[model samples]
Target: MLRFFRWYCKPDLIEDIEGDLLANFHRTLRQEGPAKAKRKLAIQIILLFRPGIIRIFNLSGFQDHFKLIQHFVISWRRIKSNLTFSLINIGGLGVGMAIAMLIGLWVWDELSFNKSFTNYTELAQLYQNRTFDGQTGTYKIVPQPMSRD
Candidate 1:
């Protein structure tokens, strides 16, 4: 009986209402028999089921909320219906992102390599054109003592 009352009563009113109900139930039980007391308690509890007595199911902005939920359901259905294609595309994206990160790191290291050097601005690269066998290639690597001056 107490559990039924607590379940129906609002949170803020539960304690006060429950205590009053129990007190009245005990008083009526002493005055009358168990049958009449139980009937009175049931009637009182039913009367407490009014608007402000119980929690309201207030669906504030229900239409907007439903539309957002519908959008999510549509997106989920699209992904679920094309599971194989989605997995393939996601895998490709992951691989491409990893390769891009590696290239970025390599470039960043090359650019910052000379930052610690005090004469970094004075440093220059040496390039040379050489033919070996049949192919001539431009190389950044040259033999030592290439600058004899």
Candidate 2:
């Protein structure tokens, strides 16, 4: 722990000073109650000259604020990628649904017509009738009689 502190506060006698403070703190805590011990610890911490706790704000001049731009760029890239992927997914689903609907409509029309026709099983088209002359004659023919079947 001492080596770690020494390395962390390079070129400074922070480790020695902290060790002395800790030793004095433990001695004081042994003589005082827990409440006074906590108060004394807080006072010591506030009085410690640790450079890590200091904040450097540029009040007199403009600050080099590039982090906000970097953050925005990253956020925009993520949004664009997500939007593109969603558009592709929605487009594929829409086209598939349209094709399915078209096929369904065609099948429904064919089946409805078949069902609406009267005597659908007996329906037939008449072919041309042969004649004695070389020319052929035609006539639309129906069933000879319903009883003939």
Candidate 3:
């Protein structure tokens, strides 16, 4: 509970607030016992999450606010400077990405072939040779087995 409070509390106020919380927790633990003390601790932590107590909201992309705008401005200027070159480069990137996606999907399909069957591990390709018009040719599957001693 204290760790949670520390995560969002302002740096300078964390030590002071944490000391106060620990002191209060000890008091409550002695008066009312552990369960009640825990509940009080959680309630106090929740109450302390207000605007003045909690640290700044630094969510994803928050730190990059100015950098993102600057990058957009620079990219816009570059694109506007050479419209034809920018369009060609963007088209090439699109085609390359599409080809990469297609190749990845194809490789996935080839690797997954025959894996859907329950007896795939026991399956094997059998080949045999036979004569047709005095010409012998080899082909898959054994229709019959011949044995001799």
What CA RMSD would you report for each candidate?
7.6, 17.7, 11.4
Put down candidate 2 lDDT per residue, 1-149, tens digits, no spaces. 33444444535556566777678777888998667766776676566536773334345433335666778899778768899886787799999999999999998876665455766666555566867668877766665765444
Candidate numbers, best TM-score first, in rank order: 1, 3, 2
The C-alpha stretches of model 1 lying farther than 4 A from their native spots are 56-72, 79-88, 97-149
User: How many residue pairs in model 1 have overlapping backbones?
Assistant: 0
Please tell me which predicted candidate would have the highest lDDT against the true structure. 3
Error of 2 at 43 (Å): 0.6
Best by TM-score: 1
Please give, for residues 17-98, the per-residue lDDT of candidate 3 as tens digits.
9999999999999999999999999999999998998888667686589789999999999999999999999999999999
TM-score of each: 0.47, 0.29, 0.44
| Alpha carbon lDDT of each predicted model | 0.85, 0.67, 0.89
- Better candidate by lDDT, 2 or 3: 3
Model 2 residue 15 CA deviation in Å: 1.0
lDDT string for model 1 (1-149, tens) is 67877776778899888889989999999999899999999999988888888876567789889999999999889989999998999899999999999999999987786677786675556788889999999998745654434
